[model samples]
Target: MLLDTFGRQAVDLRVSLTDRCNLRCTYCMPEEGLQWLGRSELLTDEEIVRLVSIAVTDLGVTEVRFTGGEPLLRPGLVAIVAACAELAPRPELSLTSNGIGLARIAAALKAAGLDRVNVSLDTLDPEVFRTLTRRSRHQDVLDGLAAAEAAGLTPVKLNAVLMRGVNDHEAPDLLAWCLAHGYQLRFIEQMPLDAQHGWDRSQMVTAGEILERLGTRFALTPEPSAARGAAPAERWLVDGGPASVGVIASVTRPFCRACDRTRLTADGQVRNCLFATGETDLRTALREGGSDAEIAALWRAAMWGKKAGAGIDDPEFLQPERPMSAIGG
Candidate 1:
């Protein structure tokens, strides 16, 4: 098991298929975008499957989520999902994407064993979407959501980040749209994970503010604390029951104490925490003929050294150098 000194065992694995993304969201990167990982630096399909198999069969990872600059952009995504689904314990599979090419591949992904998907969508308005993503593919995203639902990606989740003056006012409307469309909406607090390193706390929409804005149109009932478990989102029963919304307050209500996730970069580096300043390289070891036991031991050691928390509230907190895009969401 990937256990830390704080007694947190990692049961969830987030693997970055590629560091390349199609859309350049303002919160993620610059309009021109940062340098992407070279083809040689990225793990091959076999390497990714082997590492994921090790995590599931040996390291006790019960859930596997594939992320990237945009995972849908990967050519071998469907095959990768199929391979992982064939594992002995058969870990639950999912993907986090920008929803650009999802419409064309949603059915293929569902048939390939992807259980669900979480798409990044900040606004329902096409113009606002373009402004936030710096891309005019708002219609593509909407079509992707519809395709995902049609393909049976049940409880299709939407991850929305509210910038101070940009799309922060759409909190209620976004939630309302999700409720009407039978989609699960999760509002995430923008953290210091941008490539530009220009994240300002004052400009961010806090979890409290999000709830306050949402409260204007909807009556939300908080789910019991015991029901949250190690999940990042704190869910609330919308209105009365059945429908619900979630808030992933990574900056405000940090859930590091209950975190069960371990991350693998597109290049095969182990990231114990999303805000970690350092990484453990498994690619070098894998390429150097390291045995499965040796690789597993390396992963175990990496998780054992995980920090207690992200420390976003600390006076001297430093944003990660890789940014959200490189870090796989």
Candidate 2:
């Protein structure tokens, strides 16, 4: 297995299929949604498959994740999932989505070989959900989750950004709801990906704080799952059933030293660090008639250049200027 500068072995990759999205989550995207990437500039399905093949075979990446401004917005998402699943070794393939249009395509996704789904749902209250995501149909997210479960994506995951004063109070209630429904709920700390999107350091909630809150209500015990890559989330199983929770400590606590994953943007740029300004333009390489081996060399440079840590966790470190939409989350 190929390991990056940090001790992390390269096992997982999150590929952003499109820069376009259906919902304008105020935190990730501007209210007026940013400009979408031109069709000609995005990575072709063949190019994406080649890159993933190199990653899995050459770099020993064991898992590939499909993401985007909302990965479901991409037209050939199911095909992309199918292609990734066809990898000889068959690394774990999954997709993360906002779930706006998930109800229509959940079954097709399962049929296409998507192993799991992570739906972004922040609030239970409709009005508050509208305020956070700036979208109606708060229940649509729940419906999407139900559809995914019915389509055999059992124990569907729900990813919630635990912002202070917004949905922190609902942590216990959210856990209870997930327990009843048998969904794995993960709470992520809001990173400083977009400085202008009203991200306040004071409003941030850390993983330690989240564990404390859960411990107050349930007998939360830490699990010994392999910390394979840049996934900062330390997981725990709640007292009773198969339900569990994960804490992604992006801020207040950083996992820079053990960071492993690499991200490919919809526009075909390899971003080693989410907060880094530098990007190797693979679209240029592809367009300039670069061969597969040539493009693979450039990818190697990008991997070797992965930064120490995302600047969000350290107050002394300068934060990333790029918004979350431009970079895969």
Q: What are the per-model numbers of colliding residue pairs?
A: 0, 0
Candidate 2: segments with Cα more than 4 A from true spot: 195-197, 225-230, 240-242, 313-316
Query: What global local distance difference test value does model 1 have?
Result: 0.94
- Per TM-score, the best of the predicted structures is 1
Report each candidate's C-alpha RMSD, comma-separated, in the order given.
Answer: 0.7, 2.1
| Top-lDDT candidate index | 1
Q: Give the TM-score of candidate 2.
A: 0.92
> CA lDDT of 88 in candidate 2?
81
Candidate 1's TM-score reads 0.99
- Candidate 1 segments whose C-alpha is farther than 4 A from its true place: none
Worst 10 residues of 2 by lDDT: 1-10
Model 1: per-residue lDDT, tens digit, 22-129?
888888899998899999999999999999999999999999999997898889999999999999999999999889999999999999999999999999889988
- Could you give candidate 2's per-residue lDDT for residues 48-153 as a string of tens digits? 8878887787777888889887888888888888888888898888888888888999999999888889999887888888888887978778888989999987
Lowest lDDT 10-residue stretch of candidate 1: 320-329
